[model samples]
Target chain A: MTVSVPHSLDDAVRLLGEHPDAMLLAGGTDAMVEINDGHRRPNAMVIALNRVPDLRSWRHDPVSGTVTIGAGVTYTELMQEPLAELLPALAEASRTVGSPQIRNAGTLGGNLGTCSPAGDGLPVLSALDAEIRIVSSSGERTISVHDLMVGVKQTSLLPGELIAEIDLKVRAGWQGYAKVGVRNAMVIAVASACLAVDSEQRRVSIALGSVGPTVLRCADAEQQLSNAVDWTSGAVSPDAIREFGTLVSAASTPITDHRSTAEYRSHAVGVLGARLARRAFATSEGAAG
Target chain B: MSNQFFTLRVNGADHEIADSWLGESLLDVLRDRAGLMGSKGACTQGECGSCSVMVDDSLVCSCLVMAATAVDQEIVTIEGVAPIGAPSDVQQAFVDAGAVQCGFCTPGLIMAVHDLLDRTSEPTDTEIREELAGNVCRCTGYGRIIEAVQQVAVQRGGAK
Candidate 1:
C-alpha cells in the first residue's frame, strides 16, 4: 500500500500511466469511506491528487462564457463567490452535499469519479451540458458529461485517464437545482433535478437523478417547456408547466430503494421539475428577461 | 513489510509516525500513533463529525482524509485549540451554556464552532446551524450548542 503524492499534474498522470490500476484519491470522501468500511481493499499504489496545484484552481473565461474548474476543487470553493455567481445551480447543489465537513473535502471530480446515480453534482452538470477534460501521461481528450457517466458507480474513463477539469458554459438565464430527502442537510438525495434555461439558445434543459441508473435528461419535457415558453415575453402557462411535470414524471425510471419508493421518486422529480420551471419562468419578466 | 515512516505537524509540533499503513485514516494516525485523543472517532465515516480537524485552514472529517496523504499539511486537533489544562473561550462558553451533555461530541463541535467564528465573526442563526450541521450531537438537541456559539460570538467581539 505505497502512497504517492504528486505536486504536479504531469507527475500525477505519469504515475497513473505507470500504475493504471492505482487507486486515485481525491477528497477521499467516497474512496476513504470505502476503505474505512472495508468495502474496498487496495494492494496497488495510492495516488493522492490534493497536492496537485493544477487541479485546485478554476478559471472563468468571460469571453468564452465558460468556466473550467479543476478536478481537485472542493465543494466549499464551489459554493463561494465568483464561481458561485457564475454557476448558481452547481453552487446550490454543492451546498446540499453532505455537510460543512464533507463539502470542505468533497470535489466535483470526486463526484464524477464516483458517478453515482444520486451524485448531487452530476444532474447540474448534465443540465448545463458540461464538458469534461480527461488527461493522461500520453495525451488528453474531452467528453460531454452525459457521455462520461456510463452507469451507476461507473464511468467511461479508461485505465490511466483522470478527469482534469470540468467546463461549464455561463448561460444567460435562470438555472437552479433542487432535491427531496427525508431531512434538509447532510442527507443523500432521494430524488433530485436540475433546470437550466438557456435564453440565448431559447432552450430549457432538465435532468433528473437518483431515479435511474445514470443522471437522465428529460428531452421530451425540456422540448415541451421550451416550446411553450413565450420567447419574447418569457411567459410559460400553468397548463404547460403541469404537462411538463407529467412528461418529467414519465421520463423517470426509478426503482424502490430503502431511501424512497419508485412511485414517490417519480412523483418527487416531477414536482421538483415543475417547481424549478415555475421559478425560472415565473412571470412576464422570466429567465429571458 | 518494512515500516513506512512519515512526519505530521500537529498543533505546532511534529510527530513521526512509523509502521503506519497507507490505508489508515488521519483519525487513526492521530488517535493511535500520535496519541492525540482529542479528536474522537465515532462513525469512522464522514457522516459523523466526531473526528473533525483542521487540515491546513479547512475543517474536515479526519476519517475521510488518508493519513499518508496529509504528510505536508498542518493538522490542528481539539487539544491544540488551547493550552493544556485550560479551556479556550469557545470551550468555556460551551461549559457555561451547558452545551456539554455526554462530552463525546464536544471536541468536534468546538473545532467546528472555532472554524465558523474564525470565518464569520457574528454568524446568523442560519449560518451557525449550516456551519455546524455536520457535527451531530445526539444529546442537548443543539439548543445549548447554538447558545454556546452565540455567547462566544458576542464575547469574541462579534457583535450581534
Candidate 2:
C-alpha cells in the first residue's frame, strides 16, 4: 500500500493523476467507517488530501455575491465562521452532524463525496444551488450540486478528480433547514428539507434529502408556491403553504429503512417542508420588521 | 503501506514512528501503538464519541482520523486536557456536578464541553445542547452534563 501526502494543490493533482486507483482521504469519518465495515478497500495507494493547504480556506467574492468554501473545511469551521450568516441552514445542518468530535473531522467534501441520500449538507447545497469545484491534473471544472449527486452513495466524480471547493451564491434572504430522525442528535436524517426564499428575486427554492435517490429540488412545489403567493408582499397564506407541502410530499420517493418508514419519511417531508418554509418566512419577516 | 516516518506531537510530546500504514486511523495507533488509553474504542465507528480527542485545538473522533493525517499536528487526549494533579475547570465542573455516571462517556463529554467553552465563552442552553448533541451518554441522560457546563460558564463569568 502507498500513502501519499501532497501539501500543495499542484502536487496533489500530480499525485492523483499518477495514481488513478488511489483512494482520496479527507476527513475520514465516512471513509473509515466504510473501510472498517468492509465496504471499501484502498486500492494500491491512498491520497491524503488533508495536507493540501488551499483546499481548507474560505473566502467571499463580494462582486459576485458568492462564497467559496474549501472542500477540506470541517463542519466545525463552518459553524464558527462569520460567513455562516450567508448559509444559516447549512450551519444548522452542520450542527446536527455526528457530534462535536465528528464535526471537527468531517469535511463538507467528505459529505459530498459520500453522496448519501441522508447526507445533511446535500439538501442545503441543493437549496442554495451550490456549485462544486472539481480539480484534476489536466484542469478544473464546476458542476451544480444537483447534477453532481447521481444516486445513493454515488456521485458524478470521475477518476483522478478531487473536489476543491463548493461555491454558493450569497443571497440576502431567510433560509431554514430541518430534519427528522429517530433521536434529536447524531442520527442519520430520516428526511430533511431546506427552504430558501430569495425575496429580492421573488423566488423560492426547496430541497429535500433522504427522500429520494439523490438530493432533489421540489420544482413543481416551488412553481406552485411562486404562482400562488406574492412572496414580495411577505404574507403567504397557510392553505397555499399546505398545498406546496402536499406537492413536496408527492415529489418524495423515500424507501423503508431501519431509521424510518417510507410513509413516515414522505409525511415528514411535507410537514417539514411547510414548517421550514414558515420558519424562513418568519425569519424574513423578522429581518424586514 | 509505505514506510514513511513522521513525528506526532501528541499532548505536548513528540513521538516518532514509521508510517507503514499511513491510512490507519489515529485512534487505532494512539490505542495500539502509542498506548494512550484516555480515548476509548467503544464504537470503532464514528457514532460514539468515546474516542474523542483534540487535534490542533479542535475536538475530533480519533477513530475516523487517519494517523498520517495527524502528522505535524498537536493532539490533546482527555489526560492532557487537564493537568495530572489539578483538573481543568470543565473537568472539575463535571465532577462537582456529579456528571460522571458510568465514566465511559465522560472523556468525550468533557472534550466536547472544552471545545464548546473555548469557542463560545457564554453559550446559551441551545448552543450547549447543539455542541453536545454529537456526544451520546446512555447512562446520565445528559442532565448533569448540561448542568456541569452551565456551572462552568457561570464560574467563568461567561468567559470562553
Candidate 3:
C-alpha cells in the first residue's frame, strides 16, 4: 500500500483530493485495530496526517469565549496543563481512554473519524456544543457535533474532506465526565456521561454515550435543570439533581450488548449524569464563594 | 504493495530498513527487521502493554503505531533501554523485588517505571499504580511489581 505523509494542512487536503479513497491515518489507534482484526480491509493508499503541523495547534479566543483545537491534538496533550484548564471534561474523558499508550496515540479527530457511540471524547464534545470544521481542496464547511455524527460508526464527512479543527464554546463554570465499564481502565465504556454548566449563558448540557447509535443529548433535561437552578447562587438542590438524572435516563434508548444490559446501561448513565451534575454544581459553589 | 524506507533512532542509534511494508507496525519492524527481540508482541492489539516503547519520548504501544508514520521518530525499546550489557536501575529493581516471573511483561513494566521515575523523583503508591496500569503481568499479582517500582523510586532520589 502507498502512504502520503503530508507535512502541511494544504498538502493533506490535496492528497485527500487526489486519493479520496485513501484511508485517513492520524494516530491509528482505532484504524489499526480494525485492520488487525480484519474488520476493515487495507486500502491501497493512506493519507497520513501526523506530519501536518497546523492540525496540532489550539487557540483560545477570549473575546468569543471559544477554543479552537486542531483535529490532530492527541489526548495526552489535552491531559497536560493549560489545555486541561480550558476543557476539564475533555481532560477527564481523555484520562479514561485506554492506557497512557492509547492516550498518547489517540486524538479527538480520531474519535470523530470513528464516530463510535462508545467513544469517550464525543460525549464531552456534544456536552460542550462543539462545532467541527471540515476542509478539503474544494473549500471548508462548519457543522455542529450533533449534525456531523449521523449514527454509530458513521459521519457526514465526504470522501475528499477531513476534519480540520473543533471549535468549542468555552464558558465559565464546571464540567465533568464519568464512564462505567467492566474494568477500571483500558476498557470501552458501557455507559458514559458528560455534564457542563455554562454559568454565563445559564445553560446546562448533558450528553450520554455508549447508550445509542450516536451520542445522545438531554436537551429537555438540560432545559429543566438550567431553569430550575440559579447558577449565581451556586447551589443545586438534591431533588433537582435526582430529577435531572431521571430525565436523562428517560431520554436515552440503550441497547443490550455483551458488555452490559440495556437496563443496566440506562441506569449507569443516569447515575453518572447525576454524579457529574452534582460535582459541577459543587464546583460552581466553589467558584462563587 | 509498495515498501517504504524508514529510519528509527533507538537509544541514540539510528537503524534504517529498506522496502519495509507501510502497513507493518513499529513493533513488527523493530522485532522482525531490526532484529530487536526485547519488546514482546504478546498482544498484537494494544490491549496488552508487552509491545510498549517510547516514541519521541512519549510512552506508546508500538503495535498501534504504523511503521511508515514512525520514520525519523526516536524509539526506545527494551533492547535500547538495557542494551544487553547495561541493565538500568528499573530492571535491577525488578530483579531485586522478584517482579519477573515469566519475564514476558518485564520490558513494558520497566519502560513504564522508567517513565514514571523520569517524571517524578518520589511517586506515591497510587501514582505508581496509575503509571503501571497498562503493563499487565499474569504470573506476579502486581504486588511485587508495585514493590519493585517503589524500591526503584526510593533509590532514584526518591520518586515523587
Please report the candidate that would top DockQ against the real structure.
Answer: 1
TM-score of 1: 0.97
After TM-score superposition, what is the CA distance of residue B104 in candidate 2 from its true location, in Å? 1.7
lDDT of each: 0.93, 0.85, 0.87
For candidate 3, the per-residue lDDT at A257 reads 85
Better of 1 and 3 by TM-score: 1
**DockQ for each numbered candidate:** 0.66, 0.60, 0.58
How does residue B36 of candidate 3 score in lDDT?
Answer: 88
Tens-digit lDDT string for candidate 2 (A93-196): 99888877788888899899989999899899999999999999999999988789999989999999999999998887788789998888788899999998
Q: Candidate 2 vs candidate 3: which has greater lDDT? A: 3
Question: How well is each residue in B5-56 modelled by candidate 2, as lDDT tens digits?
Answer: 7677888998786644666778778877788888887887888788888888
Q: lDDT tens digits, residues A1-289, model 3?
A: 7866778999889888988888999888988887666787665788888768899889999899799999999998999888899999999999999988888888999899899999999999999989999999899999999999999899999999999999998778889899999989688999999999888888889999999999999988998889878666777777777888899999999999888999999899988888887787753334421
lDDT of 1 by residue, A1-289 (tens): 7889999999999999999999999999999989999999778889999889999999999999999999999999999998999999999999999999999999999999999999999999999999999999899999999999999999999999999999999999999999999998899999999999999999999999999999999999999999999988888888889899999999999999899999999999999999999889864433331
lDDT of 3 by residue, B26-121 (tens): 888888898988888887778889989999898999888887777677888887776566789889888889999999999888887888888887
Which candidate, 1 or 3, would have the higher lDDT against the true structure?
1
**Candidate 3 displacement at residue B38 in angstroms:** 1.1
- Model 2 docking category: medium
Sort by DockQ, top down from the best:
1, 2, 3
Ten residues in sequence with the least summed lDDT for candidate 1 chain A: A280-289
Leading candidate by lDDT: 1
